[model samples]
Target: MRLRDLLIDIEPLRAGRDFRAAFIARTVSLFGLGIATVALAAQVYRLTGTTVHVAAVSMVMSVSVLVGSLVGGVLADRSDRRRVIIIARSAAALGFAALAVNAMLPEPRLWAVYLCVAWDGLASGVSVTTLMAVVPTLVRRDQLPAAGALMAITGELGSIFAPFLGGVLIAAWGAGFAFAATAVTTALTSLLLTRLRPLPPARSTDGGDGGDGEGDGHDESGSPMAALRFALRERVVGGLLLLGGVTAFFGVPVVLFPELVHTRFGGGDVMLGLLYTAPAVGSVLVSVGSGWIGRTAAPGKVLLAAVLVSGLAVAGFGLSPSVGPALAALVVVGAAGTVYGILEYALVHHSTPDRLRGRMAGVLTSQQTTGDIAGDAEVALIARWFNPGAAAVFNGLLTAVTAVVVAVAVPGLRRATLPAEDDADADDTGADGTGTGADGGPGTPSVPLGTGPAPVAAPPRAPAAG
Candidate 1:
């Protein structure tokens, strides 16, 4: 393939100045989180060496994040997303500042750590949901996939590299410095995001469409229940979500890696770390060259194929005879998984109406996390009955097989098409400035943002791309 095909999609960055700001903010925020995660884990281990104690600290953040995600979704639908994000990120920065202060103490209080973690989780939850809700408004309809690709790439790089940098900092200075660094970055993210203009809630209001809801020809006004109802009601979206659920349940290789190192590889700690990090490497490479995938007609098919690739590669990694082959397989799994993720985000944003976006995004995040925890528990149970290797192979194979089944069953998803980009200006909500979206001829109707029930209309056929 030519290098151009593999080149990163820079259009979103070039086209949408606001998207560029959001992208930068995402990179900074994730990096800070990664650093804080490592610092927190190290601090916990220092205070109490037991694995259970470490897990306890983590659980506090997890519960808070879950709660925050739900609340953030509701808030995003009710008010201005840009303002919500600014406030949320500012709170996260305060969380890190608290961590820094606690770490600097001669003897850091364990309770303080838990408290700050909970605070951080709440702030992050709100930040994440509102940001996901805002991306479509930052870019054109056609750029949604590219936007997704950018986010996945940003997250993968941040998660992969930031921990290593944190480790270096911790070794040279201390956890206090790491926490301070994260605080500074979080502050920077908030400042940069502030440059964005105000974004009103996309929830439908009566007969008026959200003309200010960023030009996607959809309205954003509905209850959280409406978001859930839409997910179940839409065939393609439901299929994609089901796919996420299955993958999370069956994709338990990460949980098995430590055990596999001694049982199969005879490797040391460094090797184990390499095994863990391999997928991120693969994901980064594919993201760098993701332009070609965006040009394809059958995005859903491509996503299913990605799922299949991930399943097969992960299974192969589990069954490999030696370290080299297993590592290579893991690389493929990472690349494929990244593709699946980008497409899933693209489809979710493209298909869902504006009003329900935040809630839907929050729900999907919760489901994925739940699926992961459940899978880890289930795989551990299976390992108790069989060896870890056996459990890994079984789970991987199941993931691959199920992906095929789902793809064959959902033709609409395979044929899914994005709406053409339009010249809808964000400032023009309606002729009356009431936030009712402009009336495109025969376009699809969204939930009314007003007090009364809004009218629903059939959408026109999507026009060809420019």
Candidate 2:
């Protein structure tokens, strides 16, 4: 439970100047993006006065992101990730600039807004896939869980403050300024990225064996289809991706909450902001505790528990009568859900080899994007047919279903082990760290934990004291 030890574990990855700069840049960018999300939603609602239009905008962006993620993932596998990231950021900045400029026009054009959003979505898709894919390259394998936790922390920090701040900004200066601010932040992020050294190009297979550094041992001119096929066939990766889609469907209720507040609870923007913050607070707490959990428990078990808790919490939200109870339920749901998110990323990182990491990340991102789109659409349709409360209930049920299915189908997932810290002392660790049956190789197949084998090495240890 030493916080200092947890922090130091990730220090080696931060040793490189490029990595640190990129981290800071992304952190700032995320904050700005958070603000922009709130501002855009608020602005769009004010202009259109229709939830359908807002949902439509979201759907468009989601589709764009899905496409970009798939394309970017393939490119990342083939090219220099550093350059790909820089280009994507630049495009994102330009897209933000378009939004800012569009906001200032005499008559705001909805089409223009949609166009900017589409471009922004595409850029973000590419950026996200590249960044996730590149993380394994920056840090050692054993340090990945900590790095993933750090990432969750950054996102939670952004989520915690962004909506509140965005609301305040919109109230004071309007959406145009918010868009301009996002543009400035995007540009600054790109500039910060420029300070990093170029990443080496990804290795090509070129007739070499699949051993370390020899390449993925595939043909250099391999079809793009190869990446997709690899992702689909990899046991660990495929299961995680399916698990991700399930989580997305279950989680859609959260996005629909603002409409629920407006329609059912008779609340406005202030309440909306508070509603958003409820889950975020829980996510922040979980992110803070993730390092400790990663240390002792099997990550897969942790993931399953988180998903189930999140599902039950969402159901609780449906059962609650008032805002207070709903908020509390959201808190639980958010915390557990964030843990699920971290574990999902960890699985993707660990399951894929280094060479195809980018493509794998892209596929995961695309699946997530598609899931969001589908989930939101489902919620929207349910809301149209029934009440917002019914939609929430349905979403909760969906989560429950996902948890059960994952519990049953993905045998490897149920008992999947966290990547143990590579410490010599950790060789005999089990799921609960109580010792016994803790050999480094994969754990026995279990029902709730899924069928993926346990990691083969001792728990990864923190870097030796300098």
Winner by TM-score = 1
Off by over 4 Å in 1: 205-223, 419-466
Off by over 4 Å in 2: 1-16, 42-53, 204-228, 262-268, 383-386, 423-453, 456-466
Write the residue-wise lDDT of candidate 2 on 1-466 in tens digits: 5675443244524555555676688788888898888878887887799987887888888888888877777767667777888899889889888888877787788898899999988888887887776665565444556666666677778878876687788889888889888988888888887876555444433333212222465453223455455445545555566666777766837667777787666578778767778887887787666666556467766777787788778878877788889889988988787777766665555555555666666666766667776787788888789877788787887777777776677666666665555531243221122221221123311122232465521111001000
The C-alpha TM-scores of every prediction are: 0.88, 0.82
Number of clashing residue pairs, candidate 2: 24
Candidate 2 global lDDT: 0.66
- On lDDT, the candidate that comes out on top is 1
| Lowest-sum lDDT 10-residue window in model 1 | 457-466
